[model samples]
Target: MFKKLLSSIGIGSATVDTKLTKAQYVQGETVEGVVDIRGGNVEQHIDEIYLALVTTYIREIDDKKFEEKAVLARYKVSDSLTIGPNETKTIPFQFALPYDVPVTVGTSRVWLQTGLDIKMALDPQDRDYLAIEPHPLVEAFLEAVRQLGFRLRHVQCEQAPRYWQRRLPFVQEFEFKPVSGPFKGRLDELEAIFFVSEHGVEVILEIDRKARGFAGLLSEALDMDETLVRFTYGPSDVASLPQRLANAIGRHS
Candidate 1:
């Protein structure tokens, strides 16, 4: 009776802990880990195990700030199980992170949420923050953008609207503003949105340029009509990337 009461209140319930091979991983790579479950003060029947990739971001509407969670991926680890008291069970798992997953760059973050569902008790869970880095080509492209005098301003992952055609439910935006060269005063900001995959990368650059002429007058007054440019690249383009980036951003004819 005491064991049942304690289990009902979660004192003698099953506990879950997830262990990953490393703290850092590259986008689109596989993460190998194990979900370890240990029986508490009494033996318990385990129903299911769930693991989720999660991240949080801030959104502003009017004068209010809302913190929201984006579930990148979720999966089941086990079906049914019975454990003896003081026994430890390990379930191995491998998750392939989506290529477009928001990396732990600047203020952005990604992590895993693990849950153990007890048959007649509250579910116990765990969370582990992961360090996700951009792929090699993506990193090179970002470096090229930096060499072009665009200083990174902000980076955040937000819920992607339908038009973006994102693989995951959300998308990350890396915003930059010019600090030197021809685009300095003429451009307001340049935002980079990446659509990454195992094969290559697609970049969408949203150029917020200062308007010019009479049309500039109307644009400045209306606050609309930014420019969008898209490009696809592979590892071979790394060497001449800066020049290509400069040309794409209209730095030269």
Candidate 2:
């Protein structure tokens, strides 16, 4: 009775630990892992086991910025089970990583949160950080930008507009500045947003052009100094990205 009472209040409750097959993964890849549960002083009934892919994003409300954690995906690995005292159990699981999951860059992060649901008791939880690499086409696009002499300035995930929020509530934005090449003196900065799918990646570029003269200053004051360009790229277009991006920027600039 004492053990059950202690366990009910989480004093001697089961603990959970998750072990992933790998610590790093590319977006859209299958993630495989095992959840280990160790029982404590008394037997416990676990209602369910779940894994959640989570990350944080900044959102603004009434001019105040708030950082909120978002669940990118969730997977139920197991159903009901009874864990005996001091007994150990391992539950293996595999889930497809969401393509739109933010790549672990700058202040952005991704992690797997594992939890065991227990009735009338504190649930055991575990968190494991993951290094997420961009998809191949995304890698190619970023490389193309680098080749054009644009250096990565910042990266962040922010709340997306209603129209832009499809699978998740936020979108990851990559900011770049021209350090060399043709765009050095002509452009101010570039912001890129990627919408990735199984077929291709759609990129939205916000081209911020430098104010040139009195007219340019007036245009900037009127918020007319930025241009939005949208395009999509597939696997076959990898080799021509440099030239294509240059042409697009040139046309708008």
Candidate 3:
């Protein structure tokens, strides 16, 4: 009775740890991993095992910064099972990564979280930080942007607008302020949003042009939308991407 009581209170309950085949994965690749669990002082019945991919982002409200977590993907990896005292068990799992999972850029991050569900005892969890890399098309596009003399300033994921057809609820923004370019003094900043697929990459760029004179305040008063430029790229365009992107922004800015 004492041992069961102690175990229920998590004094000697089961614990869990997750191991992955690798620490980094491409956004669309499959993630292969195993959850290793060990039973405690008393025999216990575990209801299930859960796994999720999570990331943190900053939200500013009233001059205060609040950190919030975005759960990108999740799954139930295992069913009910029983373990004897001091026994160990392992559950293996494999799942396809979400298409729009945010790649780790600057301070933004992504990771795997594993947890065991049991009735009275506290749930044991394990967290493993993982890196998500951009697709080749996205990598080349960002490189081309940098080549056009834009300084990468900040990156964030914001709520998707009504018309944004995204698998996830949020969209990532890669903000760049021009340092030395024809558009340097003419714009406020340039933000790049990506929708990646197996065949091609779609980009939506928000051109925040510098507000001027009375037009600036009038624009604000009228709730005018920022200029958005949309385009797509594939393997064939790598050679001309830099010039193509520069001209597009120039024309719209």
Best-performing candidate as measured by TM-score? 2
**For residues 1-253, could you state the per-residue lDDT of candidate 2 as single tens digits?**
9999889888899999999999999999999989999999999999999999999999999999999999988899999999999999999999999999999999999999999999999888999999999999999999999999999999999999998788888999999999999999889999999999999999999999889999988988999999999999999999999999999998877
lDDT of each: 0.84, 0.94, 0.86
**C-alpha RMSD by candidate, in order:** 2.4, 0.8, 2.7
How big is the positional error of residue 151 in model 2, measured in Å on the Cα after superposition? 0.3
Per-residue alpha-carbon lDDT of model 3 for 92-201, expressed as tens digits? 99998877888888777898899888998888889999888988888898889788888889988766666994676678889999888787877788999999888889
Order the numbered candidates by TM-score, best leading.
Answer: 2, 1, 3
Q: Which clashing pairs does model 3 show?
A: none
Candidate 1 residue-wise lDDT, 1-253, digit = tens? 8988888788867788999999899888899999999888888888789899998766666768777887888888899888788899999999788787787987798889998878678888899999999988889888997887889889988666678856565678899989987678788889988988777889988888777789876976886747778999988888998988888888421
Model 3 superposed RMSD (Cα): 2.7
Off by over 4 Å in 2: none
Candidate 1 regions exceeding 4 Å error are 58-65, 211-217, 251-253
Score candidate 2 by lDDT.
0.94
Q: Which has the higher TM-score value, candidate number 1 or candidate number 3?
A: 1
For residue 186, model 1's alpha carbon misses the true position, in angstroms, by 2.4
* Candidate 1 vs. true structure, TM-score: 0.90
User: How far does residue 55 in candidate 3 sit from its true spot (Å)?
Assistant: 1.9
TM-score of each: 0.90, 0.98, 0.88
